[model samples]
Target: MKEKRYIMMVGAVDDQLSQVRASLTETMNQKNVITQWILSRDGIDAIGKVDNQKFDAMIIDAEAPRVLNADFLNGIGRHRNTNDCNIFVMSTQDQEQLHPNLQKYAFLQKPLQTEILLQGLSEALSQNLKPSMVEKFSVDVRVINALIKATMMVCQNYGLDQVDMEKPTPKLLELPWQGQSGAYLDIRSQVFSGGLILSFEKNVFLKIVSEMLGEPFTEIKPEISDAIGEISNIILGNAKSEFTSYGVEMTLPKILSLGQTIDQPAGSVSMLITFGTPMGKFFLEIIAHPRK
Candidate 1:
């Protein structure tokens, strides 16, 4: 997969926030970069999201109700994973009056214009950007394509407006998959076999379930588990013909709880792929092994 860029937009709920988001989305979509926009409604939430997840760039409103602290800015620059992450400040104040550290970043005037916002973002991304190059698993491209298509179709069926899929990153068989929000299924075939895991963050899982069921759900109940399994089944069912071309078949899906781990076989190869949505992010793990 091509390198994906994650951006954080920080400001209060207002027209300006909506405008900035639209501008950012257009700029990123044009580049075909699978970008994730983590909307932070206030400085405090922005700080928390930046600390927890990695971001490629951050656009902050200086006049926000909860003013961003200098320490927060410093922290973003200091974090090991995000040291290269670019910061762009939006304000009407003079840049000269701001802290010397903050002055180093790009600045945009208020009432954000699409042309200017795009220019600033393009420049920020061009600096010291490194492409992600990971080894590929031995799975056939057809299988990968089918799964990717299934994922997108499922989300669209549930009313999601945008779905961004990143390139698949290879992984060793032994390393346990991260996160507990997922459903598991077994892949069977006369020639090869493995397990498939569809994982999501807590909020994303709930949102998907709500959409699939046509109702709102705040908790992960037993029925929610069944819904996720059914969705997984649908994806597999959608991709059944593609896998059949390779002489493979998928079994019924089972709910994987938050703490359970997969026991992979020796010498097996796998790839981890992630997708971003307005609600949150989700990932897929495909582990494949040749049957002896």
Candidate 2:
């Protein structure tokens, strides 16, 4: 019999982690892959376990303080068994000035989709064991296609005008890109950091607000931001469930953002997908890297 693939999860309480676990588990079972999973509430517990056990892979939350810094990653990377194990870091913080070695690991941004996670896992599983030469996972393009279709359906069902979607454009913008209402999107590129940063023009946001609230937008209301966040949350929740074949599990949290510049870690990538709605143009960016 083949040895089961074991996955360890480290993170604070968040919806994204929960969704990740659930989705992955379903996928694993479907594929008839034997697997085990462990969850840690803090970084210390996570590191301790990794040091002691030989896990096939790790799904860690990048925002969790204990695991967020370079010291922790370095410590784990030094572990003898870790050389053959996979690491998946999830984060919403911006990555800047990350150590070069850490960039070789896998990363997932918040509001993770199921297909993206599976792609990461598949890549990690396919790699030849080596020291720090982790495989990178690309978001399954089919998932993105479905998401675009879903967004259009939701808009039309909700009585909003249909939008035209274009192929995504790849570009790297400055971190903490300013958006409307004093909000900013921060970008990061390295491990254990936020996946991508998206800044929306104030006017464009207001249009979404008006449609969601069924009222004309005169000013930036706090409720408007909350609504946008909710929309994002719903979209991600649905997307994360699309990977039922890999036994990967996850819990996505409600979207929340302070009206400040969002900070993300370094070594990240972003793909801009624009949609032309009857009201105006809207955009959604996919930011992440494959697991090594």
> Per-residue alpha-carbon lDDT of model 1 for 187-208, expressed as tens digits?
7654336778887776777877
User: Over the stretch 1-292, how does candidate 2's per-residue lDDT look in tens digits?
Assistant: 3235677777664575566567666655544455577777766787777766787777776666666565566776777756678776655542223344544455454555445566556444434434243334335433344355555555555545665665557656343333553222222222212343333455666765677778988677765665655555444455454423322233333343544333334555656666666655656665655344
**Candidate 1 Cα errors over 4 Å, as ranges:** 1-138, 172-174, 189-192
Each candidate structure's TM-score, on Cα atoms with residue i matched to residue i, is 0.49, 0.43
Candidate 2 local distance difference test against the native: 0.54
Error of 2 at 18 (Å): 2.3
- Give the candidate number with the greatest TM-score: 1
Cα lDDT listed for each candidate: 0.67, 0.54
Model 2: residues >4 Å from true position, as ranges?
1-3, 68-71, 97-102, 125-292
TM-score of the candidate numbered 1?
0.49
